[model samples]
Each structure stands twice: as C-alpha cells, then as structure tokens.
Target: MTTASTERTARTFETIGVIGLGTMGAGIAEVFARNGFTVVGVELTEEAVERGREHLAHSTGRAVSRGKMSEEQQAEILGRIGFATDLSALADADFVVEAVVESLEVKKDLFRRLDDIVRPDAILATNTSSLPVTEIATANTRPGRVVGVHFFNPAPVQNLVEIVRTVVAEPAVLADVEGLLGRVGKNPVVCGDKAGFIANTLLFGYLNHAVSMYEGRYATREDIDAAMRFGCGYPMGPLALLDLIGLDTAYEILETMYRQGRDRLHAPAPILKQMVTAGLLGRKSGRGFYTYERADSPVVVADDRTPSTDDLPELRHDIRTVGVVGTGTMAAGIVEVFAKSGYDVLYVGRSQDKVEGVRAAIARNFDKQIQRGRATEEQKTEVLGRLSGTMSLDDLARVEIVVEAIAEDLAIKTTLFENLDEICKPGTILATTTSSLPIISLATVTSRPQDVIGMHFFNPAPIMKLVEVVSTVATDDAVAETVRALCAKVGKVAVSCGDRAGFIVNALLFPYLNDAVKMLEAHYATADDIDTAMKQGCALPMGPFELLDVVGNDVSLAIQRELYLEFREPGFAPAPLLEHLVTAGYLGRKTQRGFRDYSAR
Candidate 1:
C-alpha cells in the first residue's frame, strides 16, 4: 500500500456501476456520466430507481439552468446514465463503487454479492469516509482489487478525491484508479486504509468538539458559528456544516472513528444520539441544529428561541455615546464600529498625534469602503463625523460605555482600568477587549467592579460579526445583558461567558494550529501540502499555516502560552518551531515571512 508506482498501465472503464441512488450515490453517478463514462445506477426496486432518476434529472437541470452545462450537454450527459432495479445490470461494469449507508454489515453484504457478479479483474471501491477500507476489502475474495475512493460532497463540483488502499492492494490497481480519476479532472491523493482517511480524521474531530461544546452549553449556537466565521474565516460554522451533513450521518462517522482510534476527541456528543433518536436528522428531516424553510431548501428560518435578556432587568436605555481607548488597528476599528452604528464615539489616544492618527485611520477605512461601492460618500461622512478623539482620559467621562482596546498587556490594562475608575461617571459601563488576560483582574482595579466586563471584538471590528461578552464572578448580570444588547445594536452576535483565557474561539482554535505546526515539525507533510490537505480535504477557508501567517506567529505564540499557563495542559504548549519563528521576527504577513511568502502580495 505504501509503494509508489513509476510504470502504470492505463485502465479504461467504459461502464461504471454505482450502488444506492440517494443524494451521494446519484451525485456520483452524475459525475461519471458527465465525464463521458457510461454509468449504471442500481437501486433495490423500480420505485427506488425512479427516485434516483429524478435526482439525477433535477441536478443536471440545475447545472443547465446555472449555465454550467448546455441543455444539449445535459441531455448527452443524462443519456450516459442508466438506472436499474437489479444489480445484474452491473455485471458488465469495469468498476463498481458502493455509496450506500455507512453500516459495515450492509457494505460487506453488498461487496460479497459484487465479488461474484463483476469480472475477475474488475476493481471494487467503497465510498465510506470513516470505516476501515481493509475490513471492507476483506468481504471480497480478491482484496487486491478493492479500494476506497472517497469523494467530497457534490462530486461534480468538488475537485478532491481521497483514494484509500489496503495493505494487500496492488499498486497497479491504485495507479489505474488514479489515472482514471485524474483524467476526469479530479485531484487524487493516495493514503493507507485508515479510519476517517485523511480529511474526516482531522475534520470530524474538530466538528465533534464543537458539538460537545454546544452540548455543554458553553456558548450559544449562533455565537459559536459566528466566532469561527468571523475570527477564523471559515465558510460555514461547524454546527451549520453538521446540519448540512445530517446529524445521523455525523453520528455514525464519529462512532466509527471513536471505535477505531479510541481517542476521546473522536467521541460523538450525546446530544447527537438523542437528536437522531428523535428523528431530527438535519436538512433531510427539515430540522437539526437549525430550522430550514423546507426539507431541502438552503434558507434557514429564524429561530424563535434565540437567546435574549428576559432574565435581566429591562435596561432598554439607548446607548447614545461610546468611547474607545488606544490608537492600534483594533482601537480604530472599535471607533469605526460605534460611529457607524449611530453613536457619538470618543477615542482616547496616548498623545495628540496618536489621536489624530486614529481619526485619520478611521476616515481612510470609510473612504476605502466608499471606493469599493460598499458605502456612500454621505454615509462615510456621517460615520466619520460621529467620531471625535482626545488625549485626556477625562474626555470619556460623559460616554455611556468605554471599551478598552489597548495592548494585550495586563499591567497597561489594569492601570487604565484604575484611571477609568476615577475618571468615568457613576453607572458607566467599562469593557475590556483583552483577548487572553483575566477580566476579573481588571475589574478588581476599578472602584465599580460590577461595571467592568469583557467585550472582545475580532480584528477589523466593523466587519467581524462576533463579540464575546465576558462576565467576571463579581460583574452584575444586568451589565452583561446591557453589553450584549449593545452588541446587537451594532449588528454583532454576542456570546456570553465567564472570564477565562482564550475564551471560546482561541481556546479551541490555537490547539488545532499547534497540532498542525507539530505535524510540520515532524515532517509528516510539507507546509504547502498540509495547507492543501486542509483546504481541499477539510473545506477550511484557510489552512492552519495560512491563518497562522495572517494572524502573526508572535500573537499565536502568546495566546498559546496563555492557554498553556492557565490550563497547564501539555497539549496547549506552544510548538518549538512556532516560538523559533517568532523569535526570528517572522511575524507573519506583517513581516511577510511566516509559513508562506506574502511579500509578493
């Protein structure tokens, strides 16, 4: 299985057989037919065959309507696919792929039958994403020809296909399959017949962690989703993707992985089993983590049970004024966020020049937005007009709330909080945007400990939708609610939590990045290859190294150190390679010398 082939005979599959006609199977059939390979799709009965035919028709019709293919092309494509109620129609197929349910017994039974039906030299493949391919191959007499060709969802569009081979698999068999898939414009990667293969082993573990977090009520679903999307730039939140994947399917995948690997991370959340037992099978059942407009529609209906402040007092007092400290990019972004939300913003800087610089940076951001057609000139002017800067701390006395977005240093923030304790008026809310430092420490410095809370905003606050509202042990619940409401007023999703290092996002994210760095340090794969594996294999918006570069290795190292210091977990320890890179002043995109070269940009 580990052998690499230099000489390979080209294999041709004039007819490909696909078992099961559900969404995944039908999509696979469509892919083969569209690529000019004759596809024979088999179902249990004529009714099942009709359903498969209808699915193929609907998908191809969508392709034609989207101008991805012509009507004539669709007809020609459809002409290549034939549906059958019996498996006998696949007797002449050169290759057979099983895409049925993820049950091991069901797959073994089908492979036993296919072993007797197909030609002696024909190749048999299973599309199982989690199960051990070697075990599946054991069902057949000729295990050398059995392989796993795992295709991503919507096989026609996604370019990646993980080809899994067992120890007994002949290198020639993989060479043939690779050539065939590559000829059809698919990116083929070969790996051992391990559980979860390459992608799901990494992806499903992270997803299961998200599910476990939700099950523990660590954060609201919306906030968890927004934090990843806004903070890490994932295309979809983990819960949303799980819903799309179907909770039942995810549960099965996790179960198989946990059983094979015996790792705690692969364990499925208990809530998943409960939901599946209740028949809440995600989009297929019209309800899972979220409610959809229909069983198959992509539109998510607004949930009526969204988190609200009904428990807190009715503090509906409109926030008319806000203040932000520091002259860094986050500080300037905070000023822009408040100003754009129709609040008069007071920006406090270290000096007059720095105050002027913050105001200039805020104005230039608006100007860029206007140039990009994202905002009108009048809108930019109004937003900029709402912002005012000053060098004195007393200037924030009249503001309803003062959000401290200064350096991540604890001493600097504690000193600022002490000043705010003296300078601000009574009943004013003081919030800190410290990423890792304890909010309680800052609260202790203030005379009004109940008033200080953590309101952490991601980079470029105006664009990111997530705002974590942290409440210290002494902080008032009403103050936390008020801060949450203020986040809503500014069009942000606020997740409430007790003060802790890394909060929710960084706590979960940095460990994964550190794992990737460890993988690189071990030479398991090159940085570029690991990044590609994550991007294409797991569907992340950016690979770990890519994100590390943009996030600044120096910043990541600090966060990792804080998490390690607080948790004292060996897993949270910063990678030596990461620390070395930071020590070398390779501070990511800022220095243009992180994992990947960005100086060219």
Candidate 2:
C-alpha cells in the first residue's frame, strides 16, 4: 500500500464539510450536496465564500449548457450547500474535504484543526493530486479517517473520481466513500494512496514522455500532439492536455510521482519546470504550451512561445511520375491521395482491370464530393485527369518515387524493390507505407539506400492527419525531409522517428491493447466491462476488444510479436488468446469472429 492507502486508516470524515472554495473545492462541495448530503463550504473570508458560490453556479450552468441538467434542477442541487467563513463551521460535520492550496503544510494544518473539531467518526478527505495523504492523516489524533479523493479537472464534468484509500483507512470508510461517489453519479476507481493514483500514474507518464521528446527536439509540438490525436484517436494530445491540466499542476504531480516512484519516466521534462518557473501556468495562468486569453479563461489565444526547430533539408527528386504498387484498400486509398494531389500516378498491379476498378471507385468518391457540394465537376475532372493504371512496371522507370503499398510480405517487397532498382533512375526516391517493417532491410536491396525511407500513413489517408516519417541509418536526410514536406503539402502532420518496428503509435498503442487482452484472459473482467471501463472510465475512443475486432487479430498478433522481438520484454509477449484466435481464423471483423462474434453484423 502506498501513502494514500496508509493515511486512510487514521482519518474519519462524514456529515461532509468542505474547507476552501476554489474551483475544485466548490465542485467537491457540490458533488456531496447534489447527492442529498449536507455540505459545509468553508472559506477564509466572506468574499472568498461568494467566489466559491460563483464557481459552483458556473459549473452547474455548464451542465445546463450541455443539456445534462435543467435550471430548476441546478437550483435544487445548489440549495443543499451551506457556505461559511470560519473553520469552526465544520465542527459538527462527519467528513471534511480540503481543496485548498496544494501546500503540504497548509493541508496538514487544516487536517490537524479538523481533527480537533469534527466528530470522532467524521472522515477527513483531501483532494490533493500530489503530496502524501499519509502525512496529512497522521497530523491528527484519528488519522484512520483520512482518504484522498483525487478528481480530474472540471470535477463535475469528468466522471472519474479516484477513491484513494490509505493503509490506515478503515474498510468501512472506504466502502462508504465508494457509495457516496456512486450517489453523486461519479465512477469511483479504488487505488492505493500514491502520487498519481491510477489515472495520473498511467496518463502523466505518457504526457511527460511526450514533453521529453519535445525537449529533445525529436518532434515539433504540433506534430507530437497531432500524432496522438490523429494516429491514436485521443480527444486531446499530451501537450494540449498539459495546457489544460496546467503546467504548475503537472510539474507538481510529476515531481511528487518521481519522488515516490523514483522512475525516470515520471521525471518532469526540463521545459515543464522552466515554463512553470516562468509563470506560464497553463490556462489557469493565461500561458502554458499555448496561451489563454486570461487566467481561468477557456479561450486559447495564439502566442509565439511555442518552440522552433531547424527545418529538415528540402528533397528534390528528378522526375515527377510515381508508381503506386498494390491492389488492396490501403493501396487504393494511397493511389487516390497521390492522384488527388495532382501527381501523375502509375498505379501498377497484376491486372489492368483491377487497377481500373480502383480508378472507378475514386471516380465515385469524387462524384460523392460533387454531390455534397464539396467539390466542383470541373475540379473532379481535373483530379481524375492525373490518374492512370498499368499492369506492368515498364512505365515506372521514369517515376520519381516507387511507393510499395503491397501486402506486408518481405519476400514480395524485396523482389519488387530489386526489380524497381534495376528499372528506375539511380536517385529515385524509394518509399514504403509499411506501418511495421524495418526500412534498413528494404534500403539494403537498392544501390540508392540513402533514398529509401518510410512514409507510414494512417488508414483512410485522405482524412487522417498523421503520417509517421521514418528514417533508417542508410536513409538520406534529404529523403526524409522531402517526405515530411510532401506530407505537409497533402495536409498531413508528419512526426519523424528512427526506423523501428511499430514506430511510435503501434509501439505504444499495441501494448496497451495487448494488456487489455491479458486482463480478459486472466478473467479480471468481461470484455464488455473492460471496454466500458476504458471508454466511460478513461475516456478512450473505443475499448480494446472493439479495436482488436476492427484492426484484426492477425494484424494485432503480428505487431505484438514484432514489439516483443525488438524489446525482448516478457510483458510484450503475445497473448496466447490472440494467437489462438488467429490460428482459428477468427481474425476479427474480416473473419467476423474475435472477442465477440461479429458474424451477425
């Protein structure tokens, strides 16, 4: 058990009392009040009490704005809260939650006072994201009642309420808090008292890792944010989320977690510390990664505080023609994106008719755009004029780039590249849209290894914003630079990384997905429960099993093996359940059988 769980054994809080009336404080009070519990909102002064009232009012107003509540309902919820100017107001309360400044001394002193005033059975809770809950609990005679209920920002809006139980906390107190959270319509996830608890433990590591990447100049902020949002379906990217969570809060959380866990991954990026020291406290301070209009303002105003990096050298290829090698959905999409970009596209496949069928599908897509008034007939015709199909690579000799979009078979891609090397010019840029392949081996096949690079585009390339610009040691800087520039020209965000299996997205993503599978294999939870927990509990786009069905069990298994081979970590080992599914040919939506049978669909 961590400090949070330890602290819970010492404190007792009930008949809820809330000390401090900041945004978080007022939200806490409102949560308890809305659940039909009497609330005591303690503030330093009458003016501060009024401010807390305004905060509560606005929070409820937002609920009305989102159609989640009515005006009368909001008033009824507000009526239960009783505001006061003295700590003595909490004397008779059963529980007192401190939502004041994040100073450890301030919280400890407040808990010490509450310990003196409140009844023996009253529980003491802290909404501190950082700081040891144990330290606060031990400051008083009855420390067993102290618990940490870490709620995400805009507390009422976000549904997750981390019910952190300290070791000293009685089982009954923890159970009561869980029931209280459910009464307020918040899903409580129980965890031991730790710096970040469950959500922050998992979340901040990823965010801090992204910040470190930016600090190292690995990728631009825009590209980093875009990669996760577009490539991973996150509602907001890590940097943008940092801005929302506030730089100072993030730094404190990281620092606390670092001290507690001693994990380098939890260490705050130097840039984060510097930004906080500079007073760019995110949306709360009107400045962070992106500036806001004013303190506490929701509107983000543009500023030049964003970092600048040296631009990659521009790539210049000799010819203009491009050879698109494939006949699958991805191949068709790649051909369409290239053709729409006004390139002279030579879509090579085994049959001319197959190539023409893709062309016909592109035409229908263009017709749909015209029908929707998003494209003009003349523009559609112009786009179609740049596309052509061929059954042979004879016409590919004059092409500037040979993009292999064929099935992910090494032997097939090697043979095609070998043939292309014999046919194309010496300096022709060789690019592959392979999501999971070593560009080094592919580069070795050709004399112009420097020109070979990976331009891994997300599915439905035209709509997706991210393109992983991968480079091998043999790949020329100019080749990588050109691919990034081309990606930008096509309205895509490009994040460059060294050539590695899974690159960025799949490397981080597949593990989490695989872990979800393992959780199911262990019978920890049902597939539906896990999916709902991730979606409603963690705010993900889709649950793990749902994504597996869409991505296909075969593909997920292949990627897992690749990751395991590269990392050689026991944790990354492919789950036997996934292997069994693939072996059974229950490969997901395509096979119509995976975690859930989809044959009916």
Candidate 3:
C-alpha cells in the first residue's frame, strides 16, 4: 500500500507559484529558481512586482560582486522567475507557496482564491511562522493537499525549513514536500500544525522571559545580553535579537502563541506592547531596546541609555593580595586568574599536597598556553612567582579579598564565610562562586554583610570571558562596583544582577532546555529534529538537548528545580523525562549514556 501511494504521488514539481513579493517571498522565489524550478511570483500590484524584481536583482548582483555567482548565471536565475499581479498566472504551477502578510484572513483569502486557479492536484503551502496551519488548510476545498512550508528569514541563505503537517494532510504530500526541500539544499524537519511550530515556540518563550527580566530591572540591557553571549556562546543576546526581529513582529508572534497555548511563558511582556504602540519597532524603526544610526541600519548610535565613561565608579577597597579556598578546577582557575593579573594569591586547601596540586595545575595550563604561543615562559614564571599555597585558613587574615570557590553546599559555604569573617580584616570582601545558591544566605552568615558579594565565573575561568557580579540586598554598592572593576582588571566581562537562584545565564537557559524535554516527552517531535530546528533555524551554538546532555541531566534538573522554586512559575518546572533519566543514573558523558548513548565513542 505504501509503495502504490508513493508511486501515484511521485509527480515532479516543475513550476512553483509564490504569492507576496516582500523580502521573504522574493528570497523564497530565488531559492526555488536557483534550484532550477520555474517560479511565478505574484504581488497585488505592478509596482510591488517591480520592487520584488529589483530585490532579486540586487541580491544576485551582490553575489556576483562577491564572486559567489557569475553574471550569466544570475541572469538565468532571474529569467526563471516571472512576476505577475494576478492569481491566474499560477494556473499551471504544480506547487504554490503563499508568503503573504502574517494575517490569517489575508492568507485564507489567498488560499481560497488559489483553489480555483491551480490544478486540482497542486499542493498549496503557507509560510507562516506562528499562525495555525490546520485552520488555514480548512479555508480551501482540498485541505489534504495543503501543508505549511515555513522558511526561516533570508530563505536563500538559511538551511532550515519546517514542514508542518496537519492531521488531515496526506502522507504522500508530506513525503514529496520533504524531498523537494532536500533538493533545494534545505534541511527539513517535520512537525505538527501548531502555532510557532518548533523553533519559534521554544525561541519566543526564551525571548519573552528575557524581556520580563529587563522589565523587572533584574539586570541592565547590556549586562543581560552580554551574559548570554559570553556565557552560553549564543550568536546574539535575546534582547538584541528581538530588536533585529522587530519588536512589533515579536509581539505579534508571542501574542499568537499565548492565545493558542495559553502558556504564561509565551505571553508578551507588557513592555513589548508599549514599545510597539510607541512605534519603537526595532532596527527598522531606529529604536526599540537600543537605538540605531538610522532606520534599517545595523550601526548602534549613542542614546540616553548608553553608559558614560565619565560616570564610572571608583574602586572602594584597595585590593592587592587575593585569597581563594578549595582545590577543585574552578578554585584553581580563580587562583590562576588572580596571580596572572599581578595580584599576590594565597590559596588554601585541605592539605599541603592538595595546595601543591593547584600550583601544578596552573603550571600545566601555562605550559599549554606557551605551546600555543599565547604566553611566554618569562610571563609564566612571573605569574607563578605571585602564587602561595597553605593548609591553614588563618593565612587569609592579611588578604584584602577572599573568594570562596568551595563546594556548592550552603552549609559548607556559609561555614567558610563565618571562619573568614573572624580571620580576615574588617574591610575584606567575602565572595562566593556559587552559581545557583542564594548569595544573601552567605552574606548574612558573615559579620559584615556589606562586604560579601558573588563573583560567579564560568568554567575554565582562565578562558571564558564572562563573570556574573551578584549583589545581595545588604551588599554595599561599593563592594559590587569594586568587584566589577577587579573583573575588568583581570580581563573579564562583568554583568551585574541581583542575588537570586540561577543568576542570569542559568535562569534563561535551563527553562528552554526543560521545554525541549517536555516537547519530547509529549511525543510532539523527536529529539534530533528539535535539536536541528534550534541549531539551524535559530543559529544557536548548540541545541538544548546537546547542551543538557553535556551539562548532565542531573545538573540541569537541579538548576531548573531551583528556578521553579524561586519564581514558582509552572513553566520553569523540570520535565519528568529529565527527572526519570537522572533517576536512572543516565547522568551524561560522565556516565557514557544520556540523551544519546556515547559508550561506543
């Protein structure tokens, strides 16, 4: 039965009809034409048609200048695309894709009109990013032949295309569309006909949460964006990406998803609507979260929100000698960072052997840097000269600041803070490198709460550039400012935020990973397809599943649980699949079995 159906619907699509001649539509037409399909591009008027023609010419002309294409090939590609202002032009087309405005009524009207003009067996598709594909299919008589073919922006360049299938869609139609997209050099992922599909569903939820963080004054816009870019390795921060996507368009997508799923995570932050109403659409309008040089320009100009150099804060306490606790990798890295920056470092460990082991680790790292030509032998000697190790906590009494990189238990950290408070001087800054634990708990444990802060550094601290500067309610502004300046002195980008669970990076990242798990738990899409949608469609460095597996399902679950407990938001709860995996001891690479088995490797 499958073979017979495949043979019957194996019709080759020769001519493709594209409705709407906007940036996305023209790019779609170019993609099909470049792949040798005859394309009929239809707009509402001749002027619109001419604009689309110019768009194609300009795009291809740039390719020629960049040596990516020849002039003759560009001409041939353009010649295959014929523009028209009437629906009758698509009468003989075998496939039709409507890339019209994101209005449901407009798309339904276009699909209804095309039903009479195209052949009876022709396949119709919508390029919607957030609307209901099943409802749009119901607008035409042959709903089984209609599907959603969503292309990411800049269709010609992006490799991802989402093929959304409604319950009534024929298997043959889906197979054909997937094969066609493959031929056009696109990586297609199939999913159910739902608002936001896969990429936008996960992507917008994160973007909305970032906006809410900004609205609540949890962090400055620059700090929030910098944390994601430097910590998570994302190509762009959420707020900046929202600006490029146009705040108005983002609001619309969020509104549609919220209306459909009723998930509070998808609800547009209140500030988004206010910005859209005030015409702060984003780069297109020269203003949104940031101001641009002009409309449609990428160059960011100075605005009232820009930080001024003249208003910089002065370092409160004169920090010369630094002290760190623990013998773990993070502790060693922190010790290396301080010593390399010309500060005398005194690190304490459980025993003399452990203290010497930290020094050996630093020597190994400096040796590797020398081999890579990133450091000099003389420089390594100078850095090592500044390091001192001891087995007694009393030695930290003379240091100006004590940064605890110890175990992540509150009892252990608070006990250490209490010891340091008694040993160290009155003005010594007591800092903790805890990522998820509350900094205030440790601050309150110390005698001088004003001197305690969080200097949370990323792993391989000698490499990663981000350091989250967290301040508790009792922490003095001078202490936070001094830590921020010290971070700069050591060549780290510092982002300040309130002392809270998950801080900045974990707060935004873990929930998205949890959502991906939920999507898999519901059998909405396979893990591989979800990963591909994010990596290709959203340009993220790694998919949520890949990151979760590397970060350990147990670790991710713990962080997610913390976030849920702190905010009490239902969406922040950890997925049951993740909990089950952790319970089964499928920790991650550490155990050789996680989201995917790696035992063979």
**TM-score of each prediction:** 0.85, 0.77, 0.97
Q: Regarding TM-score, does 1 or 3 come out ahead?
A: 3
Alpha carbon lDDT of each predicted model? 0.85, 0.81, 0.93
What's the residue-level lDDT of 528 in candidate 3?
91
**Model 1 — which ten-residue stretch has the worst lDDT?**
308-317
In lDDT terms, which candidate is top?
Answer: 3
lDDT of 2 by residue, 457-539 (tens): 89887778788988998888777878877776667778888787788778767876776686578664467756755676457
The most accurate candidate by TM-score is 3
Evaluate model 2: give its TM-score.
0.77
For candidate 3, lDDT tens digit of each residue in 490-547? Answer: 9999999998889999999989899999998988888899999999999999988888
Better of 2 and 3 by lDDT: 3
Error of 3 at 581 (Å): 0.9
lDDT for model 1 comes to 0.85
